[model samples]
Target: MDLDLALVRAFTTTAGTLHFGRAAEELKTSQQALSKRIARLEELLAVRLFVREGGVRLTEAGERFLPAAHEALAAGGRAVAAVSGAGPAVRIDTWGHLYAPMRTVAQAAQALGPVRLEPGPGRDWPSVAQALLHGGTDLGFGRVHPLPGGRDAGLTQRLVRLEPVDAVVGPDHPLAGADALRPADLREYTLWCPAELTRLDFLRRFADAFGIARRQDGPNLGLDHLVQHLRGDAGCFTLFPADAPLPDHAGLRAVPLVEPVPLYAWSLAWRESARHPLLDTLLRGFTETGRAHRWLDYAPRRDWLPDTDHAKLAEGY
Candidate 1:
């Protein structure tokens, strides 16, 4: 009869603990199942592995064979790991308020050594697309507008994640305590945005889409400076990605939008001709995580806008 690894593992486990109950618990199986496996192992090997009495005890034969069983399990694990190791390092760039999604990209890069996660150098998608073309970054995660008039580009975009929109209200905002809000709910209140990012068409599109006209503007402090405005009687707010790594300020809150939730996507952007061995591993990690952690929990998939000046952004977000 062939030597059964499962039965051997069970026999060794029971022999080590000298208790079928304890061994079954360690193996995540029933005590009865453990007994069957140990019995089968002993039958195949033609030797009694343990003795059952008032208390369980390993037999002389079991003690002699214990080391071999442990070694067998270790060898199997090593073989699997060796066959699955990643080849080369992948350079990754993380950009925008899209943090939660790009986490998968970082994780994928960990397998490939020398992983670099930097906020890419670019104010918008077109600039980001330029970095890829210049041949410094292997992959970029940010917004990108397709060339106008169906023009050609060297980079490819893959929608990998959805970032749900949320309200970033200050301490004194009237709707701070509301359980949830809609974009139109902010129509009466003043919406604030930084001066530098004003060029992003999505900001204007979002305001116009909801018919909110009383918008205010702030300084170009930084993309991460939105947290500063949420305090000390600011009386205003701006839209934020619900899953972004927002600051834990006492006065700020990212309340979810409802009824007609608006969302933007985070896509993976890579150079068309760029080839690297570890690329597949990074992409596979991005794809698997994207499938499970989408922004829309209730729906099968989130809607992505066209790759336009006001409509671009992505997964591998």
Candidate 2:
């Protein structure tokens, strides 16, 4: 049978403690199992390793073997470190809101070294800012909300894209059949904006620009849930990013509101204190990829609008 490092470590630890009961408790194993393993080690080595007269005690052979067992364990630890490439690894955390941009960052990180990408659900903007300042994450992606006047210092924010927010509706709706729609065109329709919509600067701007007031007690659901409602014809409309993938519902259609308002913005955020070589490489990779793809050159394929400014829309908000 092959000698296992775990077995060796177990034996060594048990031998040091002398008392099998105490060693088993420390290792979180039953005394019977610990004794079996100890017996196996002794049998394999062809020597009696311990004495159990009043309390457990190491025999002559065990005394001679302990130093070699410890040295082997230490050597095993070094081998593991070498094999695993053990070192400081970058941990990047992002909110679910920036999934696409976070994916780009994750791809860039793959080319660098070991990276841990942590995706969290909708976190408030203040928690995001605090995470960066506290060195809780190497990088983050989300909408750029204005920081408190004094708190804006010591962070680098790169505006990546802006996506136009539009009202999504069903095919039977009057506006959905129109060639184009304006905020006034939607006045009579029931608007289904999420509760979180008010907190978003762009969504608020769109509402303000169109003079459309949110319904007082409408269904306050998430983006995906609202999309379902729109498909079911439960309500007339819900606000969504023009570039976002529209759910394929037979009755669902998205109409660009006339006089486009910024609905969403995306940014690459990092702290001034994090001056790692990998960070620089990651930024360069993202820039080169963005420029190569000309990500802004394409328009949302869901609905083709002749007069729609694809370039402006691609500036992903």
Candidate 3:
């Protein structure tokens, strides 16, 4: 019987990870596609290779077939490499182009051998997560929600930074001349945002915690549009990463938030089953850079973080 290499890869990866979702992510295919390939392979062999009980498990036939499958995949990879000369570049995606994480990614890429960066996937982390799981990108960087056992869906994440945040206000705002403002100081002003408060976890939590009385949402056309809104209303303000570059507008000001400075958490996420060769180097670069620049430093009493983030950091994850 002639076996399809694609089918064999699907089986081997699924077998190795014992998780169809993660296997599909690593193979850069949909789970449905991976399942069909496995079923096709079973049909060709006239054997039930797997048993679906409480979860997926391999039958005796599947256990017996695994070693041969591994060998076949290794041979296929060797065959491809023999003609391809060099492997393909690793692909990376990031969101929040105007934030500090983008700069961190750019700096980390310098340590990689050869890589392809696909930027501006979306404005937030969920978009980046979709790209990772759908095989659109090999890796992604952004804020991450804590998942059970540090794995979510078919992806894994590692905390990379706890960046300090700054408040931006109109030049004519009452607090504009203050050297720095605290969360409580802004309680009387409106927290202007581009999305519904329910959709913005960090900002919503901040408002609730600080007893900020009002929040207003509007279209997020771009930085310029948002700045125009801020400038027109002395009672409105917004937040950005401390290192984010603000435009040179005469009426916009970036004011530091102090007395337990709010921090934005940045993370690197990838498919749990992916085994990219350069992933280690890429992560190491972030680690080394973070250490050199004190990117991960957190002072519990002097800094502010989301409760989940604070717990994760305390656990050293």
Candidate 4:
């Protein structure tokens, strides 16, 4: 029996996402084409792979075949790279380019020197993890607290930065002129966020732990829009990583949140089975930079983190 690598790729990608449209997007193909490929693969294997009843799901065969599918695709990639005399460039993806994660990557890339790193489409954990699993992306930088897959998700991650969070307030805010503020100082003011209060783990936890009375979520138009909204609302403030670049606004001020400060965890993630010559260089770059800047300084007594993040950090993940 012969296996078509393309069909296998389609299968693996679809298996990773369990959604035809998303799988097609990852493969850069139309949904119809992707469905055809999957049908063909099932025909060739003489067994049904997907149960497309109400929603896309794997049949028993597909669940059993997923691991082998990944292995076969990886072998094919290695074969192509071996003969081509040039491996594919490592693709890295992230969200919020203005944040500390991008800064960490930029400095790491400088240390990497010659290995080409291309930008990938994944912006967060689920997308990034899918990309890593299906060969769309080689590496991703973001918070992995609520990991996309379980502990055995065939992925590896290391804590790269423990960035402190700050309160972004309008100039008229009471604490705007202060050098730093204790978490307790924010209890009286409304905590405004771009997304739903429940969706923001760090902010939600901070608000809960500090007994903040009111919180609100509004449209997340963009940084400029958020800045403007925040500028106009002097009684409300939002939290941002201290390193995130704020748009220049005389009416806006980013004051440090201290006295058991809130911290955002940043980690670099990649596939466990991944192999690249420059992987070591990438890790070393982050390690050296982290060592030089004390990026991972997490004092439990003087800081607050989400429960999941705290567990991971406590375990030295």
Q: If scored against the real structure, what TM-score would every candidate get? A: 0.59, 0.56, 0.70, 0.79
**Residue 99, model 2, lDDT:** 26
- Candidate 2 least-lDDT 10 residues: 303-312
List model 3 lDDT by residue over 1-317, tens digit each.
77899898888788767789999999999999999999999999999888877888889998878756755664566467558875545566776554646788877667655554445455566766755654445678877775445335878777888889989999899999989999999988999976655546788778888898899986556777778888999999999998877787547888899997999888888887654556777788878777777888898888998886765574332
| Candidate closest to the true structure, highest lDDT | 4
Q: List the residue pairs that clash in candidate 2.
A: 161-315, 161-316, 162-315, 162-316, 162-317, 163-316, 163-317, 264-317, 265-317
lDDT for predicted candidate 3 compared with the true structure: 0.76
Task: Tell me the tens digit of each residue's lDDT in model 4 across 1-317.
Answer: 78999999999888878899999999999999999999999998999999999999999998778767876776777588779866646668885443546676777677666667776545446767766665556678877756433732888778788889988898888888988888889889999877655445666777888999799886556677777777788899888898878876446888898888898888878887764556777888877877778888888789888777766664332
Q: RMSD, each candidate, Å?
A: 19.6, 14.9, 7.7, 3.7
* lDDT-based ranking: 4, 3, 1, 2
Q: How accurate is candidate 1 locally (lDDT)?
A: 0.63
- Candidates' C-alpha lDDT: 0.63, 0.59, 0.76, 0.77
Report the number of clashing residue pairs per model.
Answer: 6, 9, 0, 0
Ten contiguous residues minimizing lDDT sum, candidate 4: 143-152
By TM-score, the candidates rank as: 4, 3, 1, 2
Distance from true location, Cα of 26 in model 1, Å? 56
For model 3 the TM-score comes to 0.70
Q: Where in model 1 is the C-alpha error above 4 Å?
A: 1-87, 97-104, 107-121, 147-152, 195-198, 232-234, 295-317
Tens-digit per-residue lDDT, 156-232, candidate 2? 76655444556778766666776657666666666665555545444455556566674522434545666566666
